[model samples]
Target: MTEEPARRRYDSLRRTAQAQQTSADIARAARTLFVAKGWAATTVRDVAREAGVSVPTIYAAYGNKNGLTWALTDAADLSADLSRLLAELESAPEPPRQLAAMVAYDRRLFERAGEVIVLLREAGRTEPELAQAYREARARADDAHRQVLSTWPPGALRSSIDLQTALDIYAAICNIDVYTELISERGWSSEQVEKWWCTMVIRELLEIPTAAT
Candidate 1:
């Protein structure tokens, strides 16, 4: 083959690889757009155009817009990280320490959940499946918190208080929506929020008397 023809063939191969890479990139971009703009507003053509590829490329790689969405959702693990944080709190040393740890853990968890929350909030408007998934994930988190509170030190205030009540209290303070509203909407500093959360948890759940400095 002539050198010119050989170079043309190599360039064609390079273009094919670049197109495949663009498909994956488009899938990710589509996820963000879908979450930010909603599924009804976003289009496969928009995703392909954003990723600098042809619409046919996206169809070839993802098969369809729904396939791309499913791929993105399956790839992300928003629930798993929250569960891991709760597990860490359960393994913590003592009630006081666990309460403090849980506060910090939840802060971190919310940071990760921020994107997922946006997706869920937008998805809930039109997608029943997505809404159901969000609810199931939230229930799992609540159950995890309840399990952690069950390990609270004995003789805590309102020892008569039911586990559900304790869980509710913790959930109220540590909830991702509550945290975002306080930290982002209300402009509370993270340190202040964490300190207050830990104090509340310590006093209510652990029943620790605060020492005067």
Candidate 2:
């Protein structure tokens, strides 16, 4: 009886691992199709075939293509280095260092979600759900900008630049699509993008000189 129960529990654990792997496979297939064909062109059936799973399995796992997109976004958000950035911002308590932290996070975000960000922008033009998701993503970014602005000590920002202006500058510079273009298409190195982004954002927003970065 003890052996049987142990075997059953092991089997259950194996099934759970298999299910997680299948979910990952489906998500990967869906992202590939969405990137290759755009949202409207890609269907759940295509994802299923690409994943080597049945259509019903795709439906059961993700419900539809939009669901898969959401999963991808969620994965991107999770994979980003936000927590470390936030911790750095909190601990540094200086504008230049905080800007570095933000740029570091932005670089990680590009590495993880650059294509997905571009895909959403393109698909949002046609898909209402993706449009809403894109809007929400911008809102989240705005909130992060506000957090970064608030973390700086007094006299950190340039006298000419107010909090709102600084926030706007943050939004403009931290754009994933722009960073992706600079790195992937324009062939700029990650170090180049990071240095330029830090320099520009610091020059525009901080009272400190850009050379500090």
Candidate 3:
């Protein structure tokens, strides 16, 4: 009887592992297709073929193209970097250090997920549902920005800059579009982009002026 129970448990574990592997393979295939064919042109069938799975598997796992894009975005997220940088920002004693931590996190994020970032941006432009979702996500980011800035020491921000304006400036300059333009289109290195991003954010949002100015 014990042997039978052990066999059942092993089978269950194997099935679970296989399912996880299938999901990962599907996600990888979807990402490759999305990048190569662009979001609008890539289909579930294409991904299924690439992953050696069926169309039903893709639908069951990810629902639709939008779902796959979301999954890809989640997979590409560098949560470890975010946590480390958030901790670094919190412990930072001064505004410059805090800003550096924030910028560093953004740099890491864009560098690792530049293609996904571009994919999402393009998808949002053409897909109404995703465009709404993207707007909502940006709204959440605004809230997060407010919370982070609230912890900063007095006089860290420019006297003329309000919370809303500060968030807008950050969004405009540190966003994926600008990153794509600089890094992908203009052939700028990741290091160059990070340095330029840091300079722009410091000059636009903070009281301290960048050396370039």
Candidate 4:
């Protein structure tokens, strides 16, 4: 009967919603442990305990800790404001303003990923799949950089600066490691980091005219 089919469809939708909620809860719990302790140190049992789900459920949902790690990382990436930043960066005409936007966008990015980034990087040393994931994340960042760089009309960067070198400079200065150093060891506030970063990007990377004394 049509009524039977409709009932089944409703039940299916409810089940799918419940499953997605469960996965989200597990990923949220896993992120805390992975950030507080390294991913290598956090076990499936720990996540299950944190999430108030059974160990079997955790295994059934994520297969293992690595799967959960990927789930967390991927979820964060999906939730970030990268698309908006990318669009804004690409549409901006002025090179100095674009560079400022890039610096600000990266700072916001680190505000989200900066906390656990070092853990992910350190785990990559011994975990092959996580290493691949880390590489893919960096590749995505590189692609974003390339997107803005390629869209700039002529005279955006110094005529003498090659594209590849510019990209390398961008990555090196805007990287998470340097961001961590600024926050953790150097004791720079986020505002300070943002200002210093913008200044460096203009001075070191951009070809703005030198101010006459």
Instruction: Pick the lDDT winner.
Output: 2
Candidate 3: worst 10 consecutive residues by lDDT? 8-17
Which residue pairs collide in model 3, if any?
none
Q: Please report, as a residue range, the 10-residue window in candidate 2 with the lowest summed lDDT.
A: 5-14
lDDT values, one for every candidate? 0.61, 0.71, 0.67, 0.68
Kindly report which residue stretches of model 2 are placed more than 4 angstroms away from their true locations once superposed: 1-33, 36-69, 210-213
Q: What is the per-residue lDDT of model 1 for residues 164-186, given as tens digits with 9 covering 90 to 100? A: 88777788777767777888899
lDDT tens digits, residue span 1-213, model 3: 354443442343244334445577786787788778877788889999998999998899988877776545443443214446545644553666666666777778677766766666667888875565456555645665676676566887899998788888988888777877887799998789878888888888888763431
TM-score of each: 0.59, 0.69, 0.65, 0.68
Each candidate's number of clashing pairs is 0, 0, 0, 0
Candidate 3 structure lDDT: 0.67
Better of 1 and 4 by lDDT: 4
Candidates in descending TM-score order:
2, 4, 3, 1
> Among these predicted structures, which one has the highest TM-score?
2
Q: Give lDDT tens digits, candidate 4, residues 1-213.
A: 354443442343244334545477676688788777776788999999998989998889888766776655544443345444545543454667777777877787687766556666777799786787678767766765675676566776777787778889888888887888889899998778877777777777666633111
